[model samples]
Target: MSKLLGLGIAATGLAHFAAPAAFEPVTKLAFADDIRNWTYRNGATELAIGLAIAAAPTRKAGFAGLAVYAAWLGKRVLARR
Candidate 1:
């Protein structure tokens, strides 16, 4: 389960790097003209988190990734307000 989730995350991250333009629509609303830059940065973060989870499929690593993602989501939510 952990490996599957990690692979999914990693794949998405790789997509961000490989086809950043495809993600423009989603990111454009948040970053505007800096969509490319934002995508790349986000991709790197996602890749790292995914790799971490894959490398260590432990409860601690899972929680760490979840916490990071939750924090990011929280920030986005707060920013929208």
Candidate 2:
């Protein structure tokens, strides 16, 4: 389980970093001109949480990351709802 978690988190973090940067003019402008801000921010944070979870050496770390993820995901869902 630990192995899988570590790999998954590391992979996602690498992927996130490897991906191209957002070419748009304003990341903060999404609220006014685009819907990208909310979506992108949530996606970015989830990856961070994934990295956090993967780096965790114990179940406690996983749980903490999961809690953070839930909170972030919940906010995104609520925003769209």
Candidate 3:
């Protein structure tokens, strides 16, 4: 009974956390030189992969996704400087 209760709570927590940000609003920025714009192009990809990992059920897949994301971020950071 305790195990089932724990599982239910954990599952509910995960579901709420995994839910899309319902209150956030998207706005268009007009600046062309904004570094965020460039970062968005690069970081968006890694962010997606990280989310994919976070949502993955298996540890191996999640870790693999994290590794890929780290490598990608490292490459970008090194390239900038």
* Candidate RMSDs in order: 2.4, 5.5, 9.8
Alpha carbon deviation, residue 3, candidate 2 (Å): 2.7
Highest TM-score among the candidates is held by which one? 1
* lDDT agreement of model 2 with the native: 0.54
**Shift of residue 36 alpha carbon in model 3, Å:** 3.7
Which numbered prediction scores highest in lDDT against the true structure? 1
Task: State the lDDT of candidate 1 residue by residue for 1-81, as single tens digits.
Answer: 777777777788899989998977766655555679988977877777777776664546755876877587567646765
lDDT (10s digit) by residue, model 2, range 1-81: 765675576555444445524423322333334545444554565566566565655546765876876775566556654
lDDT of 3: 0.42
TM-score: the better of candidates 2 and 3: 2
Clashing pairs in 3: none
Task: Identify the superior model by lDDT, candidate 2 or candidate 3.
Answer: 2
Q: Write the per-residue lDDT of candidate 3 for residues 1-81, one digit (tens) a residue.
A: 433433443443343335423211110122224444443443344344444444435435545755775576566556555
Model 1: per-residue Cα lDDT at residue 40: 91
Candidate 2: regions farther than 4 A off:
20-48, 55-58
